[model samples]
Target: MLDLIIRQGRVDDEGPLADIGVRDGRIDQVAPAVREEARRELHAGGKVVIPGLIEPHIHPDKAFLEQKMPNRSGTLEEAIRNTAALKARYTAEDVRERAERVLEWAVRRGTTTLRAHPDVDPIEKLMGVEALLALRQAYADVLDLQIVAFPQEGIIKAPGTEELMREAIRLGADAVGGCPYNEAGITETRRHIDICFRLAAQHGLPIDMHVDFADDVDDPRYTTAEYIARKTIAEGYQGRVSLGHVTTLGAVAPEARASLFELLAQAGISIVMLPATDLHLSGRKDRRTVRRGLAPAKELLAAGVNVAISSNNIRNAFTPFGLADMLQIGLLLCHTAHMGSPGEQMAVLRMATVNAARAIGIGDVYGLAAGRQADLLVLDTERVADVLVDQPDRLYVVKRGQVTVTTHRTVEVHRGPGTRSGERPAAGPSRQADRIREGGVPR
Candidate 1:
């Protein structure tokens, strides 16, 4: 007998109706008819099933700080100051608690894997890093959380940051992260990139850096990210290397942007676009007209370079409104990037799922396939456009061979024909309403 069978589900691949059988934490069979009986059966007749989405960029440490500072100015410098204040008062327990909360929200929304960057500046003693490492072990059963030992402050500009970043990696951080553009000058930024790449190579870890976030194309000094990518390739490091939030590329001269794209693609560098954070940070200096400071997503996609969209910060330090939902990210990308075409929408969806998995170097066992892991989500909507439009409820979220979360559909009742004046039908309690009445909190 099969461990679990999900029938009548519209498999993402090939757009066919099939039953997915799971056994021993992996997908056993996927076909039109599986004759074997199963221990448990889930009916997914009117639902769309796709692989669990992955988020490539997120700040999981905001859950830990006691002081909740707001970015009143909404500029990068102001955001940094606010986060610095919060980091000053952060504790290990506080970070652990907050990371857990953010992660739980992500999983319920169909994000099973995340690459969370925790601030590991010189002032904080790597408290965020320690907390996330502990969380990785605590939630290993249901979530895949990778920690980036990030220097939120400029790596070379901040005092004693190099040692702190190396220490974080020593303490089991999965990657080395840097913010080069935030440094004072081009020379300092290059120094930061060199340090980050050197440490990554020394420790044999991946490099994921927060590149330029400027909205001006004439910022002639912002090319350290390209330099790092080239150097990383030349050094014979064959691991995953990613660049997060290269927003300045959006404003660069079209010719320069195209040239940079070629260089980055040749260097085998991937990019993560944090739409929410970019929207929050860019165009602050403009009074009458505001520019969307996001990277040239459509152009990058056209060049056959992998681009993944992510939720950079959640109701925490930098950004105060995020819930770890990739659906929301996709919708925002559609609006911000003018990706309203059917093909463009599908590509945006891929950014949150398959493309994101590629960005984080987890594409081998990801996506809905015959022999992949049984990580899937059943959405309530029929068409992809409807799904993005409604942001419908996730009917079921399956991780591994077990059901992680299930939400029953709520049927809406309308007024019947020949109804009496001011007479309404007696309202029956819904499964969700009953659960809410009974204080059925999310698991």
Candidate 2:
């Protein structure tokens, strides 16, 4: 017998409705009618069924540190300095507690796979990595957590960080991470990238880095995008390197930017745009008409470069707000990136689902197709096109074919006596005389 069957679900905006059958933690069949019997059944009720959201880049270790230390200057420099002070007091228990809260929030919000870049510098030491390792095992059934030994501090300038990074890998870090822009100068930054590539080579792990995060690459240190691109091509590491927060591309000269796009596409590198943190921390120096410090998402997509969006930090010094919600972040991108059109909106959705899956190297087994791992979500919206516009609730979240999260909300709108027009009531019913009882949500 099948494990589960989700009935009458809309899988595409223009296609007919489909039913998905799950067996042995994998999708067995997806057709208009799943005829086989199942142990359990979920009624989508004509809602949209989509692949679970993937967070290609996120910082679970540093989440919710905004109140502890605030960045009054509202600059990347100050955010790092403020977070460093808090990191000094971190314990495994403390990190795990905060990370667990964020992970739970992410799962409820329909994130099935998350790539967490936990800081591995001297201040936090290995506390973040250790804490996340435990979380990986704890949430393995419901979430896929990929840990990166991220050196938020400069690898070359921060002494002994190299040893700490190697130790983090030995302790089970999934990928090698770098922050070349945080180094002392251009030379040290280049060395930082070299060290990261060398480490990944030694351990046979993928590479993700925080590269060129400034509003503009006026400083030589922030001009390492081309270098990293060439290095990826030379090392034959295509499709394995991911870069986060390269907002400088938005400010680069158009002609030069176009060339860089081609190079990135050629090297098969993925650019993960952290819109929440990027829009917050970038362009601090602009005095008039501040620029949107986001990566050139539209231009990059036209060049056939892989682009994805993520929440880099949550309620932290870097970004003061987040609910660990991918749709909220995607909607923000839709607004700031001028992607309000229907086609643009669909592209934004793909950035969160398909592009993100490829970014973290999980595309092979991570979609809604038959024989793929059954990680899907049934949203509380009927049409796939309205998924973003409606910001619908994830009524059901399935991971490995097992139901993980289910949300049920009920609302009743009661109109007062002699209500005119089709307008909604300004206030809910306050007195029994004006109240009307109804079941389910008001249409």
The whole-model lDDT of each prediction reads: 0.79, 0.90
TM-score of each: 0.90, 0.94
- Compose the digit string of candidate 2's lDDT tens values, residues 143-167: 9999999999989889989999999
What is the alpha-carbon lDDT for the whole of candidate 1?
0.79
Candidate 1: clashing residue pairs, number: 3
The lDDT, on a scale of 0 to 1, for candidate 2 is: 0.90
Clashing pairs in 2: none
Best by TM-score: 2
RMSD to native, candidate 2: 6.9
- Which 10 consecutive residues of model 2 have the lowest summed lDDT? 434-443
